[model samples]
Target: MNDSVKKRNMKVYIGKIKVMVFERGVCMTECDILIKGEKVEPVKEFVYLGSLFAYDGKHNTDIERRVNGALLAIMNSKSDSREARLAVHNGVLNPIYMYGSESWMWQKKHESGINAVAMPPLRSVWCLIKINIKTVMLESGMA
Candidate 1:
């Protein structure tokens, strides 16, 4: 509510900060929902999540980072077109792992050789759908 308080809040957005696994799901907990942004990051991890997780390291390695990227994409959504859908899909799925700790990102970018914006890419004819997910922290005032 004061000048110093606002400056502190903006600091959270001005840097590349890493959130632990526990803090992965809260986007609206620590700051106001001002200009949420998403962008893909390079993968670089080997944390085993097991088979049930279907996690492709080369692709889904940065699970946490991608999720943040996807969230940014959601904030940038404009309409329900093909590119829009891809952006949305990329945004939502960017952070999530399909198998367990593995995400479809690697598969599409590597083995499948498809860009995140190409339609009918891997999941078939079904276009991407945007889901308005409500966070637990959002209800409060801290994410």
Candidate 2:
């Protein structure tokens, strides 16, 4: 590792080294990894590059976090025009929820999860409280 770093003229920040071990679908807490005689701390989960990574290699927590973030963005936005709010939903909220999505393994539950969170904001944008989701999606050009 040191030789590769030297060859690439790259520096490894020891303070940022972390170890997370997964075995047989379970996170191991007893494992100790050492780098340059320094003990690397083990973490159950951590956010790296704006995406949450967990020990079990599941995206549930990350999905929940993204949903919450998008919801917060919707709640904080003060646009009175439906067009402006729609733009915010398509621009800001979509990116926030869909970041790093290319690497995600598509699942039925994930689609349902996204749709469940997507409706309320669309409803708010269209000022419709009792309309069907299909109408909302069609009107918003999201279907």
Candidate 3:
């Protein structure tokens, strides 16, 4: 390979390298990782392609991160119309929270967490106050 091409490839590889160890429910401490004589820093958890991965093989941190991201997106939405807000929830928020959900180990607490994140913005979209969850779900067509 050409010298310039080799240099560029090296720079790209070095800049993007990270080390993570997944122990199948065990949390491991950081350890040094070396590639081509360069030390790569180990991480307990890291975000990759907008999803969080941890050493303990749990989805709780990723779920929380996704919920927070969705909440932030909904709160920042500029639409005033209920239809538009609902559209944002369907189009933007759902994808944000549900990304990579198929691979997650399903659990009741995760469901509850997702619902807790989902309902408040929906209530605001429907101009609801002190209404019960069943009513909210029905009005939102989510029941």
Candidate 4:
């Protein structure tokens, strides 16, 4: 322990602590984390660096949270241009969802939710292109 850490109102308690078990089966043993001779509560899930972690090693909750955030980003954008919306979707929202996607296990419902969130901006781009193509063809007498 350093004086600077104490001055910052931070205290590090060290003592015997129970090890966490990560497995497919349910944990059957009773265990507790102890610090400074005090029992520290166990947590089921925690968020770190924009990713959600669970004791059971599931990503569903985190994926849902990311999806909602992306949808909100789309909803909050003020630009009516399809290109602008696409930019925000690709630049701001997609990275959030795809950050740790390589580690995620595939679930039908989660996949559906991700696909649904991704559809709107793509649809907007399609519509914008369709309208432009129609206008160009009409102007060129090729409609």
Q: How many residue pairs clash in each candidate?
A: 16, 0, 0, 0
| Residue runs of model 4 more than 4 Å from their true location after superposition | 1-21, 28-44, 49-52, 62-79, 102-110, 128-143
Q: Across residues 1-143, which tens digit of lDDT does each residue of candidate 1 receive?
A: 24564777754442453322112232323323222353222222333443222212232344344444434444444444555545455544432433252333333344222223222221321333642223311321112
Tell me the spans in candidate 2 whose CA falls farther than 4 Å from its real position.
1-10, 21-24, 27-42, 47-53, 58-79, 100-106, 130-143
CA lDDT, candidate 1, residue 76? 44
Q: lDDT per residue, candidate 2, 52-136, as tens digits?
A: 6677666443655665663666544665566878887787776766677775655677777777777778777777678798877
lDDT tens string, model 4, 1-143? 25665679878654422344334556634566555457765556555556665566664446546656536656445565666655666666667756776655555777667655555545454444334544533432323
CA error at residue 114 for candidate 4, angstroms: 1.9
lDDT for model 3, on a 0 to 1 scale? Answer: 0.68
| TM-scores, one per candidate | 0.20, 0.57, 0.55, 0.45
| Model 1 poorest ten-residue lDDT run | 133-142
User: Lowest summed lDDT over 10 consecutive residues: which window, candidate 3?
Assistant: 59-68
Task: Give the candidates in order of TM-score, highest first.
Answer: 2, 3, 4, 1
Write the number of the candidate with greater TM-score, choosing between 2 and 4.
2
Candidate 3 TM-score, true structure as reference = 0.55
lDDT of each: 0.35, 0.69, 0.68, 0.55
lDDT of 3 by residue, 1-143 (tens): 23564677755365577787766655586687666667877778777556666777664445556656536665545566778888777777767667777756566777777777778788778776676887776766565
